[model samples]
Target: MPGETVEASAGSVATRDARTGGGTAWLLGSELLTLFRRRRTWAMLGALALIPILIAVAIIIAGPAPTGRGPAFLSEITNNGLFVGVTAILVAIPLFLPLTIGVVAGDTIAGEASHGTLRYLLIAPAGRIRLLLVKYAGAAAFCVAGTLTVVVVGTLVGWLLFPIGPVTLLSGATVSVGDALVRLLAIAAFVTVSLLGMSAIGLFLSTLTTVPVGAMAATAILAVVSQILDALPQLEWLHPWLFTHYWLGFADLLREPMVWDNFIDNAVLQAGYLVVFGALAIGRFLTKDVLS
Candidate 1:
């Protein structure tokens, strides 16, 4: 009987440890579920999904967009439904998408701290390193999910309203419809990867202050400021380092032979930002006092 009781205790410890292990897989699941339950999360996703609808409606009404100075994809969308999805993603990624990411990333930790919950969360066996990783993962997940929302919704809207066929690339070459679909998916993925740097920046800012609002605003400002700097003629030397610099490299995915140079550079640039800002967040998070 004593042996049986000891076995039960050991099993219980194992189960608890599974949840509290270095992997912290259980905590990650719970946090993600919690994140999805927030109304703001749904609101952000809904806003993203709405972008394509608005674009589709506007173009459907405006006719062929002058075919010259307007949006590059405008002339193609009515003919190829897939471009609707691509254009929506292209439009949203610049501002609305990053702003939404900033709001969520900034709130992840700071929200808890401001609400007097960070201390309690840390009081548990969860390591700061583990918690920080989970928070940032949640933020990145939002980025991917948000980007996907625009793509899926836009594609559906386009398929319903416009003719469905092969997408015409900026180059004169034409590919099969199936190939175009794949390229659109790749473009969506590229857009998501491009935002990793922004996600890292947002997550780092989130760690700076207990005020979630401040963190959110500061993160958005950083993105906007980086983009502004990227546009300066005299600051061409700094373009390579800016988070927004290579964002439009998705345009390459549409080209025949699939241009890899700019695309690879963008990925490497984002990786650098991810490493630097991610390290900054982890370092600061580990040492900072959690008075809230």
Candidate 2:
């Protein structure tokens, strides 16, 4: 039954490809639709959007958090509402952000398999490689969307609840609201890249089994463990190697001149993980016996 559907549909798939000129755009679009159409995707996104709202509301009620009382940018929020997004990003990066990403990426392949649609997808024109790439692309899109959800919502909520004006950089230099917004976008980009490594890992894990939950849990756990290792002073040597090492380094983007060192290093580290884990996922998926 596993290979039967693919075998039977191979000819039809080829015919469809020939008639349609064999474009992959449709497959990718369909994948994205399938991914976002599910209620789970929006639920996770909604949860992420709430981080900044709750933070802003609590700050309004309780007054400015005592100096050094909360996340790095929290104290600044009471002065300039713009920092709300940054602070929310800082709070979520440790666990919440990755948690949502894990749910999406882990469900990439395993969810389809569990639903018995994987075999049909692998029939022809959308071969193993094409499907894998489309799946990864969908997951990556979610990363960007998820990050922006928190950022945009935080910005809006902060503006409405508190006074917004010039943003002071960590270097004590002031920048206009427009410039600060550009920096916020840059920070969001940085956070999106930071999640790619985890997405790739989740993709690989999804290829290993049909249980989406297992892959999702493993991906989130790995993120937490990486951060834990990054925190331990004893593991200083290992810190640079972990994908999460430079997560909070987005703070550098807020400096007067905007430090690019951590940004470059983080991109390179995440890229390495992406390549390694992406290859592993491809290998496993190509050889995997689809019996769902």
Candidate 3:
């Protein structure tokens, strides 16, 4: 009875300790501040802002009236934000999203190692799992921000240059401006989720290599490979499992009634990748001997 009493007391204490572990909010905040302060992050944001501007300028230079399914190209982009957003995702995800997440997450533990601060941080009261979670949360925030930046900037520029009237659907149907805007937002949200899979892959790679460059390079290579696999018609069966495959599901938003089958399947696939890779990252970080 006395031994049982001791075990119960210890269990309660452990539970309390876990609960009191500093919330993820502080870690998330710290990660965000670090990212915002970096000149490269600002530079990336600036470059993304330029995308729509360039599109607008090109349209202007060509002297073609705006054309979507309707009279204006801007209307096409807006009404079919799913298409525009997916286009942006296709372009950005391969190069930009992974690079951005890798820059931050790759630097996460390695930056600390490079600066000779990793050991000190490890020695701090925070558990390795918690610290890793903080790093991941920060990277994930960057992923969300980066994806939204592309969507918002692209949409805004497209609207400014083209007509901001009602949207014409691909099915020869028409919708009001307000309805188009709502659909665009939905599409943006979907793209954001798809981007998170890339972020998780980047973070996992970050944990594997001590050199930030190596981590970045590895992440990029993995992305490239995934894209290649997705493109192979022979590998049709594997397409649904690849994170890059569903990256275009945002296109579904443009379809009337929206195809939930592929979109939902993609979400499930991405979620599986996130969980598996995230666990591996945490496991590696926890077991790693921080000699640096």
lDDT of each: 0.81, 0.86, 0.66
Residues 114-142, candidate 3: write the lDDT tens digits: 54556655665556787777777777777
> What range of 10 consecutive residues in model 3 has the weakest lDDT sum?
7-16
lDDT by residue (33-88, candidate 2, tens digit) is 66666667888999999999999999999999888887887888888899899999
For all predicted structures, in order, the TM-scores are: 0.90, 0.93, 0.82
Give stretches of model 2 more than 4 Å off.
1-22
Residue range 87-145, candidate 1, lDDT tens digits = 78878977999889889888877877776667766767777888888888888899889
lDDT of 2 at 81: 92
Model 1 stretches with alpha carbons more than 4 Å out? 1-23
User: What lDDT score is found at residue 11 in candidate 1?
Assistant: 31
Candidate that scores best on lDDT? 2
lDDT of 2 at 191: 95
Candidate with best TM-score: 2
